[model samples]
Target: MDGLHAPASLALGIVPRKAPALDIASIPRFWFDNDPFKTRFFDALSLLFPEGEKFFIACVRDYRANITDPELQQQVKDFIYQEGQHGALHTAFNDRLKAQGVQVDRILAKQRTIMFDGFRGKLPKRYTLGQTAAAEHITAIMAHRFTHSDVFASAHPVARALFAWHAVEEIEHKAVAFDVLRTVAKGNWLIRAGSMLQVSVTFPLHVVLLMNHLLKLDGVLPNPQVWKDGRRWLLGAEGLLRPMLRDYLDYYRFGFHPNNHGNLAKIQRWREEFAEHGDARLATDRTLHG
Candidate 1:
């Protein structure tokens, strides 16, 4: 970590940057090597963010006033800003998907029904925050991979920038929900572990079902080659899931924190790259890192 960013992390936790204005207008439907499976996999995730992030903000907001730590309070404000923009930008991204004849509306309706009507606001505040924290862990793990790895090496420039930028911010406030849970839940391990267990089962199930929904739309579900390649991408050697398996399991460790990943230096480098290159950050940073 550089001199400037080290203290910020220790003192204020992760500092969320101002939300960038990303224009995904020219990004195509199958933006990654024209692969519908890959495209829909991400599209499914993106579709969840708008209302989903709003629920995250709400989860944090419920316990915000009770937080006495000034640092955590500031982090809460930044978390809202970062996640709000994420929801907005993803709404736009989903709009683009709709323009390309993707059945985003159907997917979103299903998500709202399940997330809101089925789950949100129905649980106790602590449990809700626990769920939020669990989901944040998942996103942070994914954010680290997306920004720090070559998983999206062949993705469209716009699409890659969108995820990379979102990834950095996700890393930045990755602990806010968890921290809030610790403060409010009084470090209840059962609640935390139980939440993770529930999230572990439910999240992947949703993603798989949504991915199937998306693939069916493109008539790609019947293509055996698509599943073969997707299986490799998800579970094969050098797969995204395979490398991050330990990181995912680390959540169940007795006393895990999001920063345990030790990727802050990479986050700083990306932040500097964004500062120096503006909209061209991804390309420039790739050249620098390479």
Candidate 2:
């Protein structure tokens, strides 16, 4: 394996095996509860999913074409399965927004047209994989920062759990795509470098676009609460970005190792939190309608 190291592999030896299918059933319910700010944020995120899903699907398709190692191919297949479930869960959540009279379909349609179909011809498979790797790195960092921050810690129980669950999985699978590309591409720095560059650029652009969408949807552009929450979220990005960049450099120097351990204690804490307050019935409730 291109990025595998014995020491790193040993460190990760204790990490729990990931299921082939994500337990979408465990996704928290409080995420749906109506607070104007939270709902606005959810709507903005919903808008991003169609494009994100397409991007993942594209990368997975490309990998299927190029990958030859059976074990690595199986890992990629598992990653795709989990990503597809993510798309399904978010799509369901988007439907909830539409139920609340949000203009979700129109926005997603436009995003799909532009981000998926329109850009498909311009971006090549290697570039797509690079972007995926970059996004994964960004999410891994965000997962770490979110576990440590009070902003996430103090949120509604369900909201906090939702972010943490996603974060844990991000950390768990962070190396999968990079491993795939490293194996197939073999010392291809364009994918690695391009991914890093795109991560730095596209993440902020998504945030800006999200804020703009939220402002137009809720007419809360100037609301103090919006600014306060937005500021906190942006500040949280620093914690995520710094360590992630460090890890990216480390990966280049040490090579990709699947055995690297993250803050597993945090994942445990989040699971414990979920067990305490997470009601399966409540989480499954569609009563909120949005």
Candidate 3:
């Protein structure tokens, strides 16, 4: 538990909870705050989750037998379950993008090719697992930002409920893959740092590429105003993602553990809501109406 410092209370149970049930048939194209930049920002991420989660699961499970800590072994099982649910739910939502005429399959296909397919068997397993650890660090940081910021506040309730619920679990079990990677790598920081370097370029590039695909589909890729809004919203003075840079950089530091940057305090209320209701819709109603 050297780097696994989250309170025992935070790890109460990492179960597979329901995704917020909303009819995907009628969710408007720009569902978050009616702004193209904001809505598409999330859509871009959603587009990645299916393939991304699958890769993450396999990466960690590859080292499952190496887990020596009883607590970590159990956490690994829960992590697999959680990532499975996230993939399944996001796959269902991607269909909505397909229904909206976005050709999500194309994006997914590209991901399969470059993101995981090309490198899995070709690269050393350690680097891939390190990539998993880095990716998990990034995911956890994003989860933290969403739960603590106004970023998702105006998203349609369906999306809001889904992300908020996902965020809590991500924070809860953020260290599972990292712990697995650390044990397997024997605390060699270079493997992890080298992988982060790879992810640092590729992750954001992939998301922006997906977002561009969506914007191009909507015939808005040429809109200067869209770029302006995106800049201000994501890169400008108070961008939701801007504040997470420090946390992101922290991943490169030696002896870094996810829980060092973790906390359930801000999202504690949502944690209780999910644990109590065990239903996405149930938690969502409390989130929206509360």
Candidate 4:
């Protein structure tokens, strides 16, 4: 509309699938590379989704009436279904974590308290959507990175499938929330940036809290090597964050838009792989193969 983002009728092509047949009951506790840090790193993120998606859906739905465009309104519906399914599957996955002695309910309770009690009732509606938009961007970038990040090279097939499915959907609809934000509260890049700042800090902080708890449970909390490797894994020269920092920083640009960071090929691969119920290993980025 402003020569910045995609058009209102962008046809996001969001396809919400029935729950994937993830055999959560049998997944190894250390599903990612058999390392506690890697496994719980994503597991902790799973803890965020159910609550996160709920908040994200609410933020978008609250402003739905303001969206007069039929295409965007339809995208919003598909977005809700897609995000809702993500939360459901993650919840199923998180519930499975309890079998591994993770105290998932307690962790979920903490997240719920923070979202429902702490912010939902208090934050202004527009800011909530802004934060949602910011978070979607962060997720879209992270989802994009996962496609190529070595962090997931040795990740179990089930775990890989979860991330891959979630990633594709995130990429497809990445613009919806931000477009909604632009529609209802146009030209609020500052708020988008502020919300990005808020989510950027809070998100990793919560993940750290979760990883700490999970590691302590595994009796790996005192392992200096885990922390060292993790810092290197995330912040090191060739680490996950290093390669992704530029994309993350793009959110601050005056004309930033998710469309500018497209990864359609990867999205198509995952969609095809999952549609046939093939092991998603083929759909993952080439990093896994190389």
Backbone N/Cα/C clashes per model: 0, 2, 0, 0
TM-score of each: 0.89, 0.71, 0.90, 0.90
Cα deviation in Å at residue 118, candidate 2?
3.9
Tens-digit lDDT string for candidate 1 (61-156): 988888999988988998999898888888888898788677787877887877767677477778878889999988987876675556677888
Root-mean-square deviation (CA) per prediction: 3.7, 7.0, 3.6, 4.1
* Candidate 3, RMSD to the unseen true structure: 3.6
Tens-digit per-residue lDDT, 76-174, candidate 3: 988888888888888888888888789888878888887577767677778888898898889888887776655666777777777777777787778
Q: Give Cα distance to truth, residue 134, candidate 3, Å.
A: 0.7
* Candidate ordering by lDDT (highest first): 4, 3, 1, 2
Global lDDT scores for all candidate models: 0.77, 0.55, 0.77, 0.79
Worst 10 residues of 4 by lDDT: 1-10
Off by over 4 Å in 4: 1-12, 149-151, 276-290
Select the stronger candidate by TM-score from 1 and 2. Answer: 1
Better of 1 and 3 by TM-score: 3
